[model samples]
Target: MTEAPGQITAETPPRLVVLISGRGSNLGALIEACEQGQIPARIVGVVSNRPDAGGLGFAEQHGIPSQVLNHRDYPTREAFDADLATAIEGYAPDWVILAGFMRILTPGFVDRFTGRMLNIHPSLLPKYRGLDTHARALADGETEHGASVHFVTPELDGGPVIMQARVPIVSDDTADTLAARVQRAEHRLYPEVVRRVCSGEIQWSGRILQADGTPLGAPLQLDEDTHNASPPQPAG
Candidate 1:
């Protein structure tokens, strides 16, 4: 039998196996970060549940190996996650990055990679945990919105946040507009978080700790708004 392409050997930089379910914009950011040495690790493989996922193309474009494991083929969610775990572990990844992987993972799967999986969510988290985050934020008349990088836990987006990039809400923003702006922030925020983890500036020792050995306080912020979508909204 042919071995998978992502098997980690004794000698290699930290390996990452990224999971995506849609356009690979964030995956592209990660790939760029790895290739440019901004991140000291490498993405050994990209896996998606949807074969049609556009991110798969990004993986192919970069010569990185890609695989698709359709959930529809499995009778139960647990079974799918089981096989998914097998495939991911096959790579021997140091980290599993969920860029836009849209699945509620089983507790068993979460336990298998505890402290080693990271996910980037669209909403600030503790704000909008599931779908329709952009529209919901606009409906609530919120002034700020952005993305968050967090450790993946069983509670669906309830995991502890590690960092966030806050963007000023543009007055003219529709859901699409807001989502686009936030995604740009994600491109920046996610890579920085991974870079920190890979470089040991951030470590997970039963809990997240900073380079100074201080517990990560309030999730590091990239909150400085270098660009205003509209004239900035006044602080509430």
Candidate 2:
């Protein structure tokens, strides 16, 4: 495990195991923040479900160890998650972060970790909880779209949210355009959420999420855009 870039003079930093499956823009943000003394956590290792994921390169560039456990290699999702659990446990991570891991984990695996896991969903969550969130939101003519960082549970995106950043869906926005904006929010929100979790400022109870014991903002329900300063709306 490499030392996290930031110094934690006041508290102990959590060791992190990050999972990724794609371009890894959010992972890059976290690595940069940790390296720059911004986030208060050590990235113990990076794991991916795809060997070709670009996040592996990002981790390698920063001198962090990276591993891949391809889901296709396993006989079932449960088996793959089991291997993943074993690999992550070997590193003894304090936090398991799903940066962009595209797989849905089993309840057994999620239960094993308890409140130790975190994930960022592209939508505000409790809304468009599954895949293709941006496109789905656009197709639904939603005015606002954003990113959320929440505790991971067996029920997908059902855990309480820690933090979020909102981006209005402009009328001209395509799924690609909207996704770029949401991704930027995800990049910013994930690092900040990680910092808080590592610093003991936030708590994940597995059932409810909170910041410093008080639930942060409103609940992360999707239909209302609870975290937005100015929610996006359908074009008049």
Candidate 3:
């Protein structure tokens, strides 16, 4: 069962299971953070949907156990998810981190973990919920674009956002350029959020909150240039 908000701490550091697709930069960030004692947790396992994902090599290099559950091999989404859940459960993880997992999980799979899972998206949430977020923002000529970390709900990227790091859209920025900058922000932003969650500084009790047991009025913020996180802001 998912632990209640504030249940995780340094005494009982969360056993983190990270899911990744593609490059898995966020996974690498988490790994570094764990090794450096930045987060009160250890990554127990890493899962990837594609066997060739570069993240798999990272996992192996770190001596962390990893599995690849090719979604195409499964007959249905639910079947794939059921097996995925089993693979994750084997590690007895206290938290599931979707570093770059690309699949749209089934509701059953999503609900299984409930409050114990998190994901980082490319764009600040409630604005860009789906793919190509950088391109979309550029198309709209938005002045600001960034990344967000949110609880994993079945509604794709429509989950409750917990934190964000905003970077200004430069006049000459291409989608690739913007993505590169945002990813750097993510390396900073994702690890810090995980540190907070594992340290019991942030938790989800129906809604996200601080260790003081107050609601997080607004998503946590990070400085664009320094990537330094600001204190928790009041909810509007």
Q: Estimate each model's TM-score.
A: 0.89, 0.86, 0.94
Which candidate wins on TM-score?
3
- Kindly indicate the candidate among 1 and 2 with the higher lDDT: 1
Q: Distance (Å) between predicted and true CA of 211, model 3?
A: 5.6
lDDT, each prediction: 0.83, 0.79, 0.87
C-alpha RMSD between model 3 and the true structure = 2.0
Worst 10 residues of 2 by lDDT: 227-236
Candidate 3 collision pairs: 217-235
Name the candidate, 2 or 3, with the larger lDDT value: 3
lDDT by residue for model 3 over 1-236, one digit each (tens)? 54443467545667899999899899999999999988778899999999889999889999999999999899999999999999999988888999989999999999998888999999988888889999999999999999999888889898777789998899999999999999999999999888877767777865555534557777888876665667776665
Give the CA lDDT, 0 to 100, for residue 217 in model 3. 76
Write down the RMSD of candidate 1 (Cα, Å).
6.1
